[model samples]
Target: MRVVIVEDNAVLAEGLNLLLASSGFEVAARTADAPSFLAAVAEHRPDVTVVDVRLPPTFSDEGVQAALAARAAVPGLPVLVFSQYVEQVYARDLLADGLGGVGYLLKDRVARVEEFLDAVRRVAAGGTAIDPEVVAQLLVRRTSPLARLTPREREVLELMAQGLDNGDIAARLVVTERAVHKHIGNIFLKLDLAPTDSGHRRVRAVLTYLDA
Candidate 1:
């Protein structure tokens, strides 16, 4: 697969490039800043992107913002964020739209080549692979509305929060699509959410769950 590496560290970038190349993946580009990253993506449209959570210039969340922008530019583009730290707030924003073709793994994970490569392959294959630590952080919110839900309902809600469609949720729960929709409706009611046509039900549900 063709890949782009967005890391500010020169040595690390070179190492990753060499490693991926040896692993039979094409390295499209290695960039530092947000603009250069976007440009490389536009040009190469790599099958996957390995991005650092912090990048050059400010080294804050520029890489995260760039990843978000890349998603907008190329819907369904696979992205794997490599970071040393796990920030629940950042995790919320990263998975805000829904969890498809995305991965957030600690940089230390790279030492485990088998698992790290598996994560990259999974993301490229249109799968969700969130780090356990990140998942724990996301589960901490436990929105008050979620308390009203039964165990089954919460199971469905968690899948929904992960951006799974009714069909996906049903398959996961071994139920019918109708049942999944029913669970969603119940979630909305329990959360006291007024249905709106705004195109952000997932975002609303997550925000409400976190607030609660």
Candidate 2:
């Protein structure tokens, strides 16, 4: 498998190149920014492309845009997205076209070398390898109900989706735990999640967050 990497962090890029090469994949190109990434992809037309979620100039969403552009330029180009944080919305954009060769894994997962390599291979083969955390963040019930939420509630949900507990969420949001509790209750009611034990309901809410 031939792979091209587009990441601003030189050390990480070298590490990925070494790992992939050692695992029998060809390291076609290693680039640090968007233009070079696009150029490399077009020139090499590698079997797979690895990209960080942020890149040069703005350093916000450039990598995702580059990946999307490459996929557009070369249909079905397998892409494995790496990000420092969960961006369910961005991941949705990547999958919106419905051409399945996509994978999204957290940057930290690179430490789990074998699984990361497996994700790369799976994506290169046109299979999906969404991080379990990412899926748990996306697939249960919130798509439509999400729109009904006020901005504050939506903020709470975002924090919740990241696996934060109510107390932790309150600290991050600068609100009291009681307020967080009320907001969550309202969120559950708005989403129409039936009343249940606290633990089960939290799990269900996370599931709803996934639905979007």
Candidate 3:
């Protein structure tokens, strides 16, 4: 897949470029700052764009704004955020339009090459791969509907928000698939989420609402 990277840190940008190259992905472009990043994406339209949460000028929410604008210019362009902090509000804003092909992941997760690639691939395939930490932060708000979930239910929902299926979450938690299903059912009830086309999409909508 062709990839575009938007990270201000020179060292991290080089490292990410090398990582993507070694993984057999074409590095279409590498840039920092909002204008350049958006321009690169508009010019190359890479299969996926890996962006950091902060960039030049402010180093606060420039990356987030760029990502949003890039997507606005090219709807469903498959953007994956690589950030150290979990800004739940930004996550919600990114998904405000309910557009798929998006991912919000922690920068620390890059150490796990396979997992990072999985998230990238998932986003490219029009799936959500939200960070569990992002979900945790969203759940912390008192107004979060997830506040009604039990501890186990919350754990299951957290994994689900990461785009994991019942089987995957079951294996991760070392529990039976049936137990995972049961927890999912309870989760739907607690969150007042109605069933959708399939498992992951429904859970993704719930997670989106939590972030919203």
Strongest candidate by lDDT: 2
Query: For model 3, what is the C-alpha lDDT against the true structure?
Result: 0.79
lDDT tens readout by residue for model 1, 1-212: 99998998899889888888888889989897789999999999999999887676655567888888898898888889887745444556777666458889988755687787888888888887778876664575444446667799878877877878889999999999998888877766555453552366667776765665
Q: Report the lDDT tens digits of candidate 3 across residue range 117-210.
A: 8998898888888887776666674377666668888888778777788899999999999999888877654443434434454655456546
Better of 1 and 3 by lDDT: 3
Task: Report the number of clashing residue pairs per model.
Answer: 0, 9, 0
lDDT of 2 by residue, 163-196 (tens): 9999999999999999999999988765645454
In candidate 1 the C-alpha lDDT for residue 205 amounts to 74
Query: How accurate locally, in lDDT, is each candidate?
Result: 0.77, 0.83, 0.79
TM-score: model 1 vs. ground truth: 0.63
**Residue 92 of candidate 1: its Cα lDDT?**
68
* Leading candidate by TM-score: 2
How close is each model in CA RMSD to the real structure? 14.6, 10.2, 13.9
